[model samples]
Target: MCSLLLVYISVYFCILLFIEFLLPFPSQNRRHNQQINQKSSNFFFVFQISFMPKKMKSRYILLTLSIVIAIIAILASQTLFSTPPRVFIHNPFDILYGIKAISYSAITSVCSHHHHHHHRRKPSHSKKKISICGDFPKNIPPPDTDTTSYLCVDKNGCCNFTTVQSAVDAIGNFSERRNVIWINSGMYYEKVAIPKTKPNITLQGQGFETTSIAWNDTAYSANGTFYCASVQVFGSQFLAKNISFMNVAPIPKPGDVGAQAVAIRI
Candidate 1:
C-alpha cells in the first residue's frame, strides 16, 4: 500500500512539471516573461514546502511498519523451531519428587523380579493317587524277617549297619521289591543321597522329634541350594517317614542378604 501511494505521488509531481513547461510564456515581451517566470518559481517553492511534511510522514510510517514486520517474523521463527520444556507433576512439599519417583520405580521393579524368582523356587504340592507303601507280610517273625528286604541302622553298632548311608549303599540298584531301612533314635550329621538306580526304598525313623539328619553346606560354601540340601532323593517310589531334614547353615548378618540353603530336595 505504501509503495502504491508513493508511485501515485511521483506521477502527480511529473504531471505538474509537464504542465508548467507546456504553458504559454508570451515570448515577444521580455520584461513580462521575467515577471511570469519569477511568479512560477515562487509557486513551485511553496508547493515543495507544503508536501515536505506528508513525504516525511510516509517515510516514518514505512520505517515503523518495517520494524513491526521484522519483530513479528523473529517471534514466529522462534515459536516454530524452539523446543518445549518437558512436563512433570510437581509437589510443593517435596522438592526432589522427580528423583524420588525414579528411585521408587527402580526399587519396585527389583522387588517384583525377586518375588517371581522366589515363587518359582518354591516346591509344589500334589497328592499321589497310588500309595507308594502297600501292606507288608504280617506273618513274618520280627527277628527272622527277610534280610534281603529289611535292614536296620544304629549309631551304637547294635543293628545291621552303623550309618544310614551305609545301609542304603548295601542295597545296590535293588528295584524288584521294596526295601526298608530303620534308623534308631539319634542326631545324624551326614549328607545322604538316594540315587535313581536304587528305587523302591523306604527310610524309617524312630520318631520325628527323636531323629534328625543335618548338614551345613550353603551357597557361600561353593554349593547352591539344590546341592546344599541335607537329604537329596532321586530314586522313584522312595519314601521317608518320622524324620526331620535340616540344613545348619549360618544365618545372614545384619544388613546382609544371602542365597537359599535347602533342607531337602527330591
Candidate 2:
C-alpha cells in the first residue's frame, strides 16, 4: 500500500508540470502576436509621417511655381499690348521747328552749308526742268507721249523695264545728272525704294488716277513701320509726279489695335 501511494504522488507531480508548461506556451504565443501587430502599426505610422508630408510639399512647390509663371506672363502681355503706337514726322516745316531750337553757331553752319548746296544745285535745277518738259511742246502731253528717258517702265513690256523698281535699280547710286523714270499708265504692284546714295531722281507717271503703285504690308507684319512702306524715298532732290501710292493691307477691325501701315515714306 505504501508503494501504491508513492506512484500516485509521482503521477500527480508529472501532470502538474505538464499543465504549467502548456499555460506558459499559450501566454508566449499571445505576446508574440501582440509584438507583430505593434511592428505593423509602427511601419504604417512611419510611412504616413515620412512619405505623405514629402508628397504634399512637392505638390505645393509645383503649384506655387505655376502661379508665379502665370502672373509674370499676364503682366508681360499687358505691358506689351498696352503701349501706344509711335509717330514719325515727315513734314519739312515740322522738322524745321526742331532745327530752329539749335544754337546760333549750329544754325549759321547749317545755313552756310545749305547755301553752298543750293548754289551747286541751281544749275542742275534748270537742266532737270528742261529734261522733264522740253520735249512736251504742249503744256500737257497726250496720254501716251513719245518722250523717253534714261529708264522707262511699262507693264506691257513696251518700255526698257517691265517694273518701276527695275528702272530705279538701273539708275544705280550717286547719279550726278537728273535721272528720269517714266512709268506708263498701269497698276504697278511693287515696293520701290530709292536709297540715299542715289540722288537727283525724277519719277514721272501718267495721270495720278491712271498710274498706281500698290503693296500689302503692315507695321504689325514681320517688317516694322519704317520697312513696311510701299514706296520709300531717301535720295536727295527726288521727285514723284502723277503717281498714286496705295497700301492694300487690311484695315484694323473694330476693337482691334495695331500699328499704322504707311503707303509712302519720304
Candidate 3:
C-alpha cells in the first residue's frame, strides 16, 4: 500500500508540472490575449500621431494664407485702377510696391511734380513759339497822340488805330513764331495780354520812353478798373526789351498806385 501511494503522488506531481508548462507558452488563450494587448497599444499610438488637435498650428496656417491673399488683392487693385506709367522702368522698388503705367501726353499735361524723371523712355521733342510785332500790325494801335499813334508793332508796320481796342481785335490774325517785333520810336499807349502757349516771344521797343504803356496811377482813375493797364502774360519763354510800363499819374490821389501795372503771369 505504501508503494502504491508513492507512485500515485509522483504521477500527480508530473501532471501538474505538464499543465503549468502548457499554460505559459502553448495555450491559445494566452497567446490571443497577448496579441490583443499589442494591437490595442498600436492603435492608441497611431491615433495620437495622426488625429492630435493643435489650435495654434492651425491658426498659423490660416493666418499665412490670409496674408498671402491680401497681398495679392492689393497688388491686383493697383494694377487695375492706377494710371499707366510714362517710362518703362524696371525699378527694384516696384517689386515691393507694384508699379502703374501712364501715357506721355497725360504725364506732360500735368505740371504737378517738382522734379520729373524719365527712365528707359525716348525724349520728347520740344516745341518752339515766338511773336514779333511790326509797325503795321494787322490789329489796331494801342493808343494815339490826338488819335494818330500806335501800340502793338509787328513785322509788317505800325497799326495806327483810333483806339487800342481795334489793335487788340486783330492780334489773333498775327503770327509771331520766334520773331522779334521792331517798334519804331513813338509814344504807344496800350496794355498787352500774352498767353503761355506762345513761347519764346520778344517784345522789343523802339525806345524805352517812346514805347511807353501809360495807365492811371490808381485803380480809381477814369475807367475805374481800367485806370492804366491790365496786361497778363502766361508764356514760358518771354522777352521784353526797351519798353516802359508806367502808372505814375498819382498826382493828388492813389487809386491803383501801389499795384503792379505791368503784370507778368509766368
Candidate 4:
C-alpha cells in the first residue's frame, strides 16, 4: 500500500511538472490572444498558477516537492513500525504444560467423537484373565495358573511381566504349541525380540491407541539397520494384533551415515 501511494504521488508531481513546461506565461502572449483564450474557458481559475511570476512558480514547485517528500517519509516510517515482533519461549514448564494441554484436548475430542458416533468401547467385564482387555486397560491381572496359553504383560506390575521382552523370553524353544501373549494398554520402551527358535507366537494388545512399543535406536547408535528395530520377529507363524511399534529417533539429516531407524523388522 505504501509503495502504491508513493507511485501515485510521484505520477501527480510528474504531471504537474509536465503541465508547467507546456503552458507559457500569460504575460508573454499578446493581449488579444490571451483575452480570447481566457474567455474561451471558465476553468482558467484552476490553471491560474500557469500565469504566476517566476518567484511564485518556483515557490509552488518547492512546496509541492516538500509535501510529497513528507508524505513519503511518513509512509516509510509507518511501514517499518507496523510489523509485529516475534517472541521466543524459554520456559520448560510452560512448554510441558502446553504439550499436556494439547494432548488432553486431543483425547477429549476423540472421546467426544466416539461418543457422538456410539462407537466408544466399553470396559471389559469378563471373569477370565485371558480375555481381551478393552482400550486403555487399567488394573488388569495376569493368569493365576501357569498352564494357560496366554502370558500377560503390563507396565503396572499387575501382570506376569512389566516388559514385553521378558514374556517373549519365557516361551519354550521349538514348542509344537502356539504361545499367545496378551499385552495390556501401556507404553513398553524396550527392544523386543522373538528368536527363530521360538515359533508360532501370537501377540495381542488391548488397542493400538493404548498399547505401544517404542524405542529411539538409530542405525548409528545400534550399529546396524537390522539392530535398530524396536521389535524384531524371526519366528515363523508369528502374528500381532491391536498394537503399535514406533521408532522415536529423530529424522536423519541429508548425507547422514547409518541413521536409518526401523519400527519393526519381521
Best by the TM-score measure: 4
**What is the TM-score (0 to 1) of candidate 4?**
0.45
lDDT of 4 by residue, 82-153 (tens): 321211144423434544555677789899998977754665567556644334355344443444367789
**Candidate 4, lDDT over the whole model:** 0.74
lDDT tens digits by residue: candidate 1, 1-266: 32233345555555654565466644455565465556567577445434334433454455455555445335423523222222122432242443466567778989999999999988767855653223323432144334437777767666668788998899968556778887877888888999989998888887889988888877666355568888889999988899888988888677554456778889
Candidate 2 off by > 4 Å: 1-149
What's the distance in Å from true for residue 115, model 3?
A: 88
Model 3 scores a C-alpha lDDT of 0.46
Residue 81 shift from truth in candidate 2, angstroms? 96
Query: Ranking by TM-score, best first?
Result: 4, 1, 2, 3
Cα lDDT of model 2 by residue, 1-266, tens digit: 22233345545555654564355435445665466556557586444434333434454455455455445335424522222122113542432343344345577888999999999877554444434323432422224334323567777766668898888888857867777787878899989888999888888888899999989888878367888889999999988899899999897787654556889899
| Clash list (residue pairs), candidate 2 | none
lDDT of 3 by residue, 125-216 (tens): 67554434432434343433442223454323433443333444434433444434445556445556565454445566767877655544
The TM-score obtained by model 2 is: 0.44
Show where candidate 4 strays beyond 4 Å: 1-148
lDDT score for candidate 1 against the true structure: 0.66
Q: How accurate is candidate 2 locally (lDDT)?
A: 0.66
User: How far in Å is the alpha carbon of 217 misplaced in model 2?
Assistant: 0.6
Summing lDDT over every window of 10 consecutive residues in candidate 1, give the lowest-scoring window: 80-89
